[model samples]
Target: MPLTITIPQEYGYVLLCSTATFILSNWHAMRVGSFRKSAQIPFPNHFATPEQIAAASGDRKEAMHIFNCAQRAHYNFLENYVSFLPALLIAGLKFPVSAAITGAVWSVFRIVYAVGYTKKNTPNGKGRIAGLYFWPTQLVLYGLAGYTAYSLL
Candidate 1:
């Protein structure tokens, strides 16, 4: 007898969430690249060193802020995505419906985080507060997904 698995509707939602996260990551990276170009940051052999990045934004406070924010947003996504992707995959496979919902929620949090980080002059400390609120929620979701997968093994 062949082993069989049934995919649930929520799996599609998880996929959509994953795609949205990817798009957000790409947008941050593009923003960084655009800032670098606009600032005339020289890229030696298409790669920027720390020194090069510093030099590129030299004496320009706003330019440095933009570059730092963009870089932070991009790197933050990359760091989180490494853990999120595997957790999402395992959760979607093991507990599709709940995992997918969690994944979607996490994605929304991530978007908020990115936007908060990138946008200028958000009122009432909204941006920072948004990120602070969502980050732990996302981490909890990842932990739950991981634990669920581990329990199944």
Candidate 2:
């Protein structure tokens, strides 16, 4: 017997948000790769060391600084994405529409966050501002997850 699993139609929004996030994630990685080459940071190293930076063919200081920021931005997206995906899927089990809306909000703000981060060279830059709005959305997803869990009990 072939068994079929039924998913909620509202889940479509989650998938859309997920796709957008994937695109954003890919862009961040590509930016990192491009900057890494310009910065001449080697395969195993996340940032260019002093000697490596000094030897780079481009504007050494700016190239290294930009590459470092790109790398950090890419990794930061991955860090949050991992947790968000599982929580979103779980929350969708009971509140698909709500989960998707919150997820979409997060994905949108993530772009702002990443763009701000990549554009600014500082450790804490304007990118952090967008993140403040994302927290409330994440909290809503968590609340939905709790509802789903309680329903399953």
Candidate 3:
């Protein structure tokens, strides 16, 4: 006899959402790298520091702004994703369908956040507004995940 494990449909949705998130995150990172290269910042030997990037930019304020925006977007994604991933996993195991739907929502908002952050000279504070929407939804999703996991225990 062979041993088998079954995962719920909701969990499958979570997996799909997670995959989408991973792909989008990497795409943003690559965009940042492109910005850095275009700015003529030397690619990191091991790790590139803010000082090193600034030194490379050398009086090019526009280049510096673009580099900074890209870096901010990258870091922001990492910060949110790190915490969100585990919560999403736990929640999906307990409340798969809802968790998966929430995860998808979170992923979409994140994309909006990144685009808002990266776009140059966005009018009417659009990027900041988008970020405002993103944060609350992210927080709510994390909370829902935590509550779902806790209820199961």
Candidate 4:
């Protein structure tokens, strides 16, 4: 059999996807930091803006809320990307095109999701929608990878 460990074209695409995600994550973090600096306050852990704080409370509460949102988003983004990267790599070696396509789809959804989540203070509906739209693509990639592995047995 051919050498399976050689880098595949799909792997390169997946790498691009990973790099894009990292850039976006850092970009969002910086945006959050900008907000915090502008507010001249510490960050929050839940909401993304102090404006989300209860009406009864003051600006500090709102700022805290925004900080919290930023923190949660940052961590979650890291976790998701890390988990998916290895999977992409595995799939790439065995099923490069599928892996690359799935990675591309995921990257697009993530970008949309982040913008929707941050700009409108809304839920991740757009992102979720994109995810749903991309599910079939991901499944196809996963299936291809699994098939490749099974064939080797």
lDDT of each: 0.65, 0.76, 0.70, 0.60
**lDDT of each residue in 33-129, candidate 1, tens digit only:** 8866754556542334457555654445345455556566667778888888777766776666666677767767766776676566543224644
Output the TM-score of candidate 2: 0.80
Q: What is the TM-score of each candidate against the true structure?
A: 0.70, 0.80, 0.76, 0.64
lDDT of 4 at 134: 38
**CA deviation > 4 Å runs, candidate 2:** 1-6, 50-58, 120-126
Q: What is the C-alpha lDDT profile of model 4 across 95-144, one tens digit per residue?
A: 77677778788767656555444443344323334334434555565676
- lDDT per residue, candidate 2, 47-117, as tens digits? 76767656665466777877776787678778877878878888987778888888988877777776776
Candidate 1 Cα outliers beyond 4 Å, as residue runs: 1-5, 44-59, 121-129
Candidate 3 scores a C-alpha RMSD against the true structure in Å of: 4.8
User: For every model in order, what is the number of clashing pairs?
Assistant: 0, 0, 0, 11
Please tell me which model should have the higher lDDT, number 2 or number 3.
2
lDDT of model 2 at residue 47? 77
Ranking by TM-score: 2, 3, 1, 4
TM value for model 1 = 0.70
How many clashing residue pairs, candidate 1?
A: 0
Q: Identify the candidate with maximal lDDT.
A: 2
lDDT: worst 10-residue window of model 4: 123-132
